[model samples]
Target: MREAYLASGLTLSDLSVQVPLAKSKLSELLRGIGLYPRWEIVSRLAALLRLPHVPLYRLWRQAAFEAHKSREWVERSTDNTTALTTSPAAPPLDHRAFCELVEADYLLYAQTFLIDDTACHNAVGDTFDILWLTWNEALASPDTRSYAWTMLRRTIMSRTPHIDGRPHFTHAAFDTAALTHLTDEQARADHLTETIALFQVMGWLPPTQLDVTVLRILWRMPTERVSELMGVPPALVRSSQHHAEHFLKSALYPTDNEGRTP
Candidate 1:
């Protein structure tokens, strides 16, 4: 309701006048849903938002159904409604959780891609030149490169669904396998070196601080874990994360640069 009202450029007061319910009661209804305006208030708020009420209502109903289904899946082990509804190959992810994961993946990928691309574009030398040097120095033999590629392929494959109709949720398994395979000191050193080089090329880190802290935090930690690691309050972490995300997008797809908004 608030999102619709804001998008329509109308205040709650403006909406209250058009609705049948008293403003105070409308406010209470909205407050019940983490919004301040009641449904009666937003009854005409749809028009202000330039959206028909019927479609919006339908969308809201669908969202509510999905939320209810997700909760049901979490609470009742016997119920496999969601699993049965989705394709067998698709992981039995709770709808809300899967959406959140997908959103985070998109944001992280965009940030990393932008930072890397920009660094490569500004370099006086060939961008992959550093990657090649790092590979040569870190890898003991030609076989090492093949091994690394295999490790990478396995990790990617584990997260992805098989070509066959097998139903598997491979993320946890994939991480375990990757960590186990790359636990050797030499492999760890090589990975760290390559990661640092890539970050340097992306201007995400300086030579003095080769750890790529932000990327590590984003990749290795959950949002709540990131807050704990940063040692700030959760709210502050959220604010900082949002600002950092905006900065990354701006860096990658500048306003003056023609193309998508990112």
Candidate 2:
């Protein structure tokens, strides 16, 4: 989409005014950054680009299917796209029920890390869409919840921007800053400095420790649920959280050159 927009010689501002979607969302669409867009938005953009509607809709359908959107919902979103594709297999009721049950958990997990509502929602929706595609396999597994949780993590992690091969947490700086109720300028600055340091240290932790820290400390999910989602024993979850806290303390409060606490 970015390539198409570039080739068409239309500025982002032009596309923003022309398309029905918001400018920020349009930018995300063009960059392929956020949730897979609904067909109507894409179709209008394609029309503006003089791209063939049928071919674009086919591509969009495949993406939407992968993102876990229902065929019925996709069809309802745009008649033109619906006409271009054959009817898809309906998602099972069991899968639907599973999605309803875990969607909030998935959203909370994503938001606690991603920090952007759109990206968080997209990750959750994509997780379910992927689980729907693999429902039979998930059912065959001894623990369906575990299998689905793995799928959800994969979906979210892939979308999570990384720094030096670790999950990036610097994006959370804005939200972290917003949490402070400090009124003094110096105090607020002090709080933000520590918050950013903590977020950066979080990105440096080993993956398992990072996951445990986020679930147990930041999101405040119960240890049992964290254990299930991570496919780890509850004891291990507690241990990891303990180690993560230790690491954070060391990283954020280093000893001085003479071995004295700073």
Candidate 3:
């Protein structure tokens, strides 16, 4: 509880007010969940401690596997084919590609980390129409470009606990700071290329199979809509997003397991 409070910039009293459980009960709950008071609790802790309705999904997964002796049931149920007809059976991604994708995603996310709510909204609104047009056209084609387009769209549009309201770029400020040195056309092209490369690496698609045109379509998409298209559930999306962020952070700023920068 203490660590969670510290990491979230909230006090124990502040959390008590937000959460339904009494302070004592909450403390007990935290202890039962294997968290020491000194360990830094992240967004996961905040969600678990404050929101009565928000399930402790990670904990549940852990316990479920421990109890069941195998994750086969969960895996079977959550298999890609069970969810979306469009979900492809691509090979696992290579480490290099995964690292590159993680890096690009981190860069994109870094652009919006400091934006205020109003700015976020305005950016999303402005970017959505253009992205939608490009996405629709890309979807119409049935090649590797189409697959990349689908994957990118699904990744960005899927619902996540971190983002609320409509999944539109207007809601999130589009970060142009990274492109300040480039011409408008160059910036757009670069954005498309970087984002496409990121997705290709993450999705584990081969360079020969990657479609630059599809990436062009994704570049214009609103972040929220992209999340929706990804078909990831809202809560899971947030968790996955967190993992992706962590992966990027680790890559960009290499550190020991103790969290000290190398």
For TM-score, the strongest prediction is: 2
Better of 1 and 3 by lDDT: 1
Q: Which structure is stronger by TM-score: 1 or 2?
A: 2
* Higher-ranked by lDDT: 1 or 2: 2
Q: How close is candidate 1 to the true structure, as a TM-score?
A: 0.25
Which parts of model 1 have CA positions greater than 4 angstroms off? 1-21, 29-44, 51-63, 66-177, 180-262
Ranking by TM-score: 2, 1, 3
Q: Tens digits of per-residue lDDT for model 3 on 1-262?
A: 3443444566556657645556775666555653322111222344543321112223334444545635665454334321112222231234224324333432243223224544333233222322232333334545423344344433334321133332223222233434445668977776756543443333332221222212212244444443443333445435555555455445444665566857
TM-score per candidate: 0.25, 0.63, 0.22
* TM-score winner, 1 or 3: 1
Q: Candidate 1 local accuracy as lDDT?
A: 0.39
Worst 10 residues of 2 by lDDT: 81-90
Rank candidates by lDDT, best first.
Answer: 2, 1, 3
Output the lDDT of residue 226, model 1.
Answer: 43
Q: Please, what are the lDDT tens digits per residue for candidate 1 over residues 99-203?
A: 343334333423333334332232212212222222332255444323333332232233333324331222222223234568689886665554443333333
